[model samples]
Target: MRGRTVVEFHGEIDIATTRQSDQHLDAATARSAPSVLVDLRGVTFIDSAGLGPVCRAWRRAVDRGGDLTLLCTDTRMLTILRLTGVTPAIAVTGS
Candidate 1:
């Protein structure tokens, strides 16, 4: 049953850890879950590579009439996104 996949990632996630994050996201995509909740409460860092996959996931959700909701409990990640000015582009919650 393809349903929602809630992926919670922690620790530093930058270009160095992109592949690792990608692997997780790819697994979620492969499942094609109806809804995906990416919780970034424990994330210590995130580069474009890390952000790209989420955007891609959002697109995939839209394409499939599904939804991708982002829940972030880390302020550091929010700052990075604000500075990058891509938070609005991607659905994010809890700055």
Candidate 2:
């Protein structure tokens, strides 16, 4: 919440949806010190292709002196993020 731009992702995140996801993430992280919250609780599945855009967004936010947080309670998604080393890089919160 707060002043962060919240981007909620739903369904499966795979190669088929990475392009669109990337576009959205890029736009969200385009400004200076953009605080973004990526809501992934609605996501059912996610692959490495899906994580690419998220990592990129996190980097962009950090480079701009901002930050990105991930809100996910799904065990599968959380595991994927942990296994991919994204949990340490991005702030993750669960409900």
Candidate 3:
């Protein structure tokens, strides 16, 4: 929370939320900030479809030479991230 540029994905971010998430992800990329923190604290569930937005956002940030980080991931979410080998890519902390 706080001042972090948090993107809280509640449910699945499939075709439904893809447009909105893309907007946020694009904003995160366009900003000339040093870093962008996408807090997933409020997210209760996710799937590969949901992960698409995350990857898109991360790629956006990287394109702008900025860093992307996520926090407040639950066990299931953590497993997904770990299994996908993205645990090392995003700076995950304080789950």
Candidate 4:
């Protein structure tokens, strides 16, 4: 994990926190890491708005020739991401 950076997301995620999350996600992904991990293990609830920042951060990492992976274990959140077709866009793994 020396060349990787992990950005942890905590608690519930909704439209109210998108801006803050996006800002932090952007900053984390913008760092000089070969891979970026958006850790969602601590997140309880997530909606479409929550997915936006994660997707955007993934795109930013990809545009910089880096990989952005998601670290998530919650079954429901994983199901939501899968049903929304976001799982295929970025690598999703467990801690």
Per-model TM-score versus the true fold: 0.78, 0.95, 0.80, 0.91
Encode model 1's per-residue lDDT on 5-78: one tens digit a residue. Answer: 88888887677777777777667666443577888998877888778777777777767667777888667778
lDDT of 4 at 1: 46
lDDT of each: 0.75, 0.92, 0.73, 0.86
- Best first by TM-score, ranked: 2, 4, 3, 1
Q: What is the lDDT of candidate 2?
A: 0.92
Q: Which candidate is the best by lDDT?
A: 2
Cα lDDT, model 4, residue 50: 86
The lDDT-based order of candidates, best leading, equals 2, 4, 1, 3
Best by TM-score: 2
Tell me the spans in candidate 4 whose CA falls farther than 4 Å from its real position: 32-34
Cα deviation at 60, candidate 1, in Å, is: 1.5
Q: Write the per-residue lDDT of candidate 2 for residues 2-57, one digit (tens) a residue.
A: 38899999999999999999999999999999999999999999999999999999
Clashing pairs in 4: none
Instruction: Name the candidate, 1 or 3, with the larger TM-score value.
Output: 3
The alpha-carbon deviation from the true structure for residue 4 of candidate 2, after best TM-score superposition, in angstroms, is: 0.7
Q: What does candidate 4's lDDT look like per residue over 1-95, in tens digits?
A: 45677888899888999999998888877765448888899999999998999889888888877889999888998999999999887889987
